[model samples]
Target: MQLGAEDTKAIITRMKRAHGHLGSVIRMLEEGAECEDALTQLAAVNKAISRSGYALVATGLQHCMAEGGPDSVDAKKLEKLFLSLA
Candidate 1:
């Protein structure tokens, strides 16, 4: 989980993009935009954030597994980690 500057920057970039999308949803709501349109945008933002989070988790797991070697594949821990994310 100890990401270097470049890796951290990549995560930050994804977060910023998600934030921007969230802001757009807020702006649309504040402007009294169509409900369906706003909901659609909200869904898109949610999907983006979920995808980004999963990607980060997968990257972290991959790095941990690599460092920890073959025995790192603990089913219980993996299930816990995934459930906690959910």
Candidate 2:
């Protein structure tokens, strides 16, 4: 299912934040930051990415359920996608 403009914007915003966090983590590593500090930044980046993934999956599930009900193939596909992240 196609995403509405708002959902697409929200997803893109999440991905952009994740991208920025990843860049910061890379910079921290390159700058010889403390291991603990670097690890903390890395964890933040990981969480941001995970949140983005969850948002995408949630949007897909929402659309699938609305359009085809919970038992539809699209819903199953979205479920698999979400589980793969785990």
Candidate 3:
């Protein structure tokens, strides 16, 4: 789904930060950093990515509803999309 800046600025920023954090996580693994530290960062990156997915789904749903009205939304599809994130 196409996202406008207004609808996705925070989400985009979060994903970008998570992208950087993932790189760090990879580097930590490559350098054999402490397991606890690496795992902590990795977990944070994972949660950030999941949150981004949820936010994107929310934006898409809102856009669909606003543009096409509530009747145009397919509940089954929305549920599937949300479940995929889970």
Candidate 4:
């Protein structure tokens, strides 16, 4: 399913934020930050990316269900796509 306009915008915003967060994690490592501190920031970045993936799947599922009848939606395909993120 094509991304709904709002979903696309939200996803882009999330990705951009994640990009900035990831840069911070990298910088922290380069600056000789404590291992624990750098790892914490890295975990935040990972969580952000995972959340974005979930948002994408959830939005696509909604779009597919709304645009096509229930019978037209492929549950298996969507499930695989969602699980791939895991």
Most lDDT-accurate candidate:
3
Q: Rate the local accuracy (lDDT) of all candidates.
A: 0.81, 0.83, 0.93, 0.87
Q: Highest TM-score among the candidates is held by which one?
A: 4
lDDT of 2 by residue, 21-64 (tens): 88988998899999899899888888888988898888877777
Query: Which one wins by lDDT: 1 or 2?
Result: 2
Q: Per-residue CA lDDT of candidate 4, range 1-86, in tens?
A: 56757768988899899999999989989999999999998999899999999988888877777888688778899889988998
* Residue-level lDDT tens digits of model 1 in 1-86: 47567656777788789899999999999999999999999999888878777777777777778889768767787778787768
**Residue 32 in model 2: lDDT:** 92
Q: Candidate 2: TM-score? A: 0.83
Give per-model CA RMSD.
1.8, 1.8, 1.3, 1.1
| Model 1 local distance difference test score | 0.81
- TM-score of every prediction relative to native: 0.83, 0.83, 0.89, 0.92
- Residue 6 lDDT in model 3? 90
lDDT: the better of candidates 2 and 4: 4
In candidate 2, which residue ranges exceed 4 Å CA deviation?
71-75
| Candidate 3 local distance difference test against the native | 0.93
Error of 2 at 59 (Å): 0.5
